[model samples]
Target: MDAKVRNNTAHSRYELTVDDATAVAVYEIRDGAIAFTHTEVPRSLSGQGVGSALARGALDDARAAGKKVVPLCSFIAAYIERHPEYKDLT
Candidate 1:
């Protein structure tokens, strides 16, 4: 899982490709905030931290862009809860 996440702005998502499988975190920008709406990781990639990596990358992007975060996706919300360093993003 050395793959780096990329922001696909045209598609409104962050993507991480590993072993030909791609995981995504879908989001929408509203009122200067990035609202994460969904997260998906291939079943074959589950339990391998793909989702966590995606979430961290997305949140880091948001921070870099000076945008707040609205974690509408349950997975993202849970990730933030676990990683308090990103709590201020919400």
Candidate 2:
């Protein structure tokens, strides 16, 4: 199933959903950009591309929001490096 990305204000987090209550990744927005700050996938959901999905979603969201990405998180930095399209916004 496709994942949906939702902002969870109460938690100050973004939720990546596989289904209701199934969050494979979570992130936070800091400064002017989206931060892939925290992430996780269920052991059952491992090796299924959930992390990449979350990264893409977060980056796309940042782009759409007209925000620059700082990529303080290692995974996010690596992802931005790999996807040069996002470098313009860094």
Candidate 3:
């Protein structure tokens, strides 16, 4: 959990760096909505919770910014669905 997920607005994504690999959750902001597009984790880092961590961080960022989230990415939709506290974010 020490890994910090940071928002890279220049690339319109949230990223987390592990030992050697990077996990990214892509997003697009337009017309006041933040649309989560995709999430990717290096195969070598699979099953280590990197993706979940990345998702959580991205959602948290959106919440803090008081922005509406459009979970276009299934992973993000599922994450919010499973986490009821975040359901109101959509």
Candidate 1: C-alpha lDDT? 0.95
Better structure of 1 and 3 per lDDT:
1
Residue 66 of model 2 has an lDDT of: 95
Look at candidate 3 and tell me the lDDT of residue 43.
97
- Better candidate by TM-score, 2 or 3: 3
In the predicted model 2, the residue pairs found to clash are none
Per-model C-alpha lDDT, please? 0.95, 0.68, 0.92
Q: Report how far off residue 39 is in candidate 2 (Å).
A: 2.3
Quickly count the clashes in candidate 3.
Answer: 0
Q: lDDT by residue for model 2 over 6-65, one digit each (tens)?
A: 667677555676644444334466775655565666666667777677777777877888
Q: Which one wins on lDDT?
A: 1
What value does the lDDT take at residue 40 in candidate 1?
A: 97
Which of the two, 1 or 2, has more TM-score? 1
Pairs clashing in candidate 1? none
Candidate 1 local lDDT, 16-85, one digit each (tens):
9999899999999889899999999999899999999999999998999899999999999999999999
